[model samples]
Target: MAGGRAPRVLILLCILHLHCLQGAKILTISFVGGSHYLLMDDISQILQDNGHDVRMFYQGYQNMQGYEKTSVPYAVSTYNMEEKYLKAYDELFHEYQREIFISRDRPQSLFPLMTLYAKHCRLYMNQTDILDFLKQENYDIAIVDPFNPCHFLIVEKLGIPYIAFFAGPFSYSLGNGLPSPPSYVPMYLSGFTDRMNFLERVINTFMYLGSYMVEIRNEEIFSGVIEEHFPPDSRPTLSDLYNKAELWIYNMDFSIEFPRPLLPHIQCISGLRAKPPKSLSQDLEDFIAESGDSGFILVTLGPIISAVYRMDFIKEMNSAFASVPQKIIWQFKVSQWPKDLKPAPNLRLLDWVNQNDLLGHPKIRLLVAHGGLNGLTEAVYHGVPVLGIPLFADQPDNIVRIKAKHMGEYIPFYEIKSDKFANMIQKLIKDKSYKMAAMKQSVIMRSRPFPPDQQLLGWVEHIIRSGGGGHLRPYSYQQPWYQQLLLDVILFIFSCVALLIYIIVKVIRFLIHLLYSRKKQKQN
Candidate 1:
């Protein structure tokens, strides 16, 4: 070959290589309140790091707002968290475990409550705005957490591949019969923990059905607006939305989360756990170095729950730590220490410190947390056992999983007196079992084929490279559950048997009528 031809051939190969490595520029749209964004942001960064473009469209409220004005490529949608919503959420979260919908107790009760709560923060929020943003950007695929089932319809309109990101302990696959997480600790049983019994399952079923209604409503609202505003060839249903999606990136590991049958499209990528920030400030470093190996306890109630209960928990924890020989590092996120409550020699409080770093530090032994999944992941990541004080939603479920794994112990939030808190702390630290369990999980969690961040990128690349294969679509509710169980055939047989019985009865009546007419003639 000529020299010029060689260069041309090389150029062709390079282009082929680039095309082979081609990944879709993923556009992630997440709701405000849920912790979905935390996982999505990590996925987004991984995509970006691998030379794939990412654009985030989030309602600038709550934690999502923290990324605002940062160098990340993102756009803020019209949803903003109002003061009233925050106040109302605070009130609800205080008793969240009592009120969370495990099943359909009411129509549009659980989801609408959450959406309405979110809407109270931002009024003019519509599904169209999100669609319009998607249409303009022309994203290759849309990654959404299933909680925002409303947004799934956006993918149907644009004919794009979408994957619902499940970012918690639970799993929801199409073919999985119904949406049931491994186990949920009953709200009524505060002390004794067990799986949802028959009644709870019935209620949970109702709640799931109610969520379906909300999904339909959301689809109608979105499709109706699409029909009004833009030209549409065909309107899409909720089923259509599921069909168009390519995959479900379940944010859980099989090792940590129990094995459940999942759809072909669903893949477990649970390793993408996170802590606030790993790097500590100079003051934190100095504090850790000067602690003289007393082994501090890192206390945090999580972000939302922290706002309400932090001060009280801090005071009680302080009281408990007074007798213990260990130091205390409280993650308060504010410098407003009570003037009267002077800092003890062993106690240091900061508004915010790198949570993972604190856990990984040699000086830190135990974590006092509200049992959020992220905190649990970090605790497990560093092999530090927890004294879980769960607040709401999946916190109780998470704590149950933690304790079941033998990695941690849980104390009910209502039972968080100083003495009890101190006893639990002492039990976790002094006992070798908790750390051993955590270390076992850590070893298994680390032994995975790839880091969660890289695994996430691979899935996205697969979508782009395969041009969004239909094979990756989740089989959720696709097969009539009746068909799967051979119930349809059973019903057909029952109907046929009934028809045969009816025919026999009709023939018998006809014969009797004829016999009666003959007898009347003879009498005449």
Candidate 2:
């Protein structure tokens, strides 16, 4: 009877332990498409795996964004945004790309697209039903994509504590009292790495200051939405909302990115997506095997680029691929390929390839890419070297880091000559050091004390269980800009030193005059 009682007591204790750790309700928001949705979806999936109820809300202009998530474990709410503004923005971008490649002009700051962004925000707030569902649900915490200022507004309206999942560089966190020294930390769109000379540093500093101007413009973009939807008395600036985020998990890993200063609340989750790849499809296997010992290059210019970019770019790429001895697996649209041009003999054009799987294949020589963070992270994980033909966005600087690390090289979009492109590919294939460097980075990425998935899961749960990450936040956010920078303290010290020097000069002058006067009187 005593033994039976002991077993029952153990069962009760186990039940009690399970009851103590209840799963927290999490709401994730993703309004932007592509990588933004991918990151947020992954976050929601992970939370659900841990027995939490996760609801992901997606609103965007792009229709084709979320279809890739075929096995989502979380509940999702989606809203299709009006595309009137996006159509106009696309026209401007199309023209902008034309100007850069056709005119042989130097690259400049991209179009602001403020109107397009603002319109999306307005449309998103107009979703009364979705907003009502979110409000009724009463989520414990919200994980938002700060890419669209609209998601921030939604979270603010709901009055829930939030975290950020960002794909941009560290410079974006500058406004939130995060340390972003311009000397090393490059501007988000500057396309520069940490290592810069005197002139580059000057440019980087100016670009850093220019980011504030861009933020001011971003505020202007969202001002109308706030005025139209929210109460007049409590207008929340997008910049202010960005500052209040309890934690930020970037879609970046140190394996590819340069090291920079990050706070306790700020962390990177790049290594989480790096998985041991599965086998490719049978057709893909046959294509990869055709290269034999020579190997094949994997080219994916991202989904958007393949569809929008002109045929001249394709022609140049094709000409280059034709020159190389190795086979090429290029991710491009079959429908977009012009019938007038002859396809490269060694090239296989696929609408989609298991990019991660291809990168993991032993025969993958080097990745011919646009230098997006996702593919770069995968390449580093699999120890595959990259050679990027950077088109736009952060691709230039992303490639800059790859070149700096000596694991890869980058060619400007305007400079894709057949001979030069082919030569670069040959160099990468022949060079053993690039492969070694990539492998070293892979080892570093996987060899962390705690793997990236554990870090991501632990920190998020830590925040959820504690109600918020208020304890991890530094008191610096509450301080004024001058105080945060220690500008006032600097001025005080400078003023005291100046006063002391002034007094010393005055005393010395007076003493000198008195001595001279006495000496002159004696002489007289």
What's the alpha carbon RMSD for model 1? 6.7
Output the number of the TM-score-best candidate: 2
Per-residue accuracy of model 1 over 1-524 as CA lDDT, tens digit each: 59889999999997996775654567776664435776666677777777766777665554421223345644344455567766665566444433432331232334545555334323323455655666787777878776555456445555556777777654234322333442442221122234567777666555544554655665554454445433566655555555556776666765456545555666788757643346677877787677576678888775544444445655776788776777788765454556567666777766555577788777778988877677778887778888887765557667777887888888765556778878888888889999899889878877788887878877877777677746654353477757867898999999999999999999999999999999999999
What TM-score does model 2 achieve against the real structure? 0.90
lDDT (Cα, tens digit) per residue for candidate 2, span 1-524:
99889999999986765564346788998877776677677778877887778898886444232134465778888886446666775676566655655553232343254566677677778888889889989888899987677878989988888998786556466656567889988777677778888998999889778777877777777888999988978988887788788897787777778888888888888755668889888888897798889999999887555556666777888999998878999887777778898889999988767688889888889999988887888899899999997766667777888888889988887778788888999988799999999889889888878876678778777787676878777888778879978999999999999999999999999999999999999999
Instruction: Point out the worst 10-residue segment of candidate 2 by lDDT.
Output: 60-69
RMSD of each: 6.7, 4.2
> Each prediction's Cα lDDT score?
0.64, 0.79
Alpha-carbon deviation at 300 in model 1, angstroms: 1.9
TM-score of structure candidate 1? 0.75
Separately for all candidates shown, the number of backbone clashes (residues 3 or more apart, or on different chains) is 9, 0
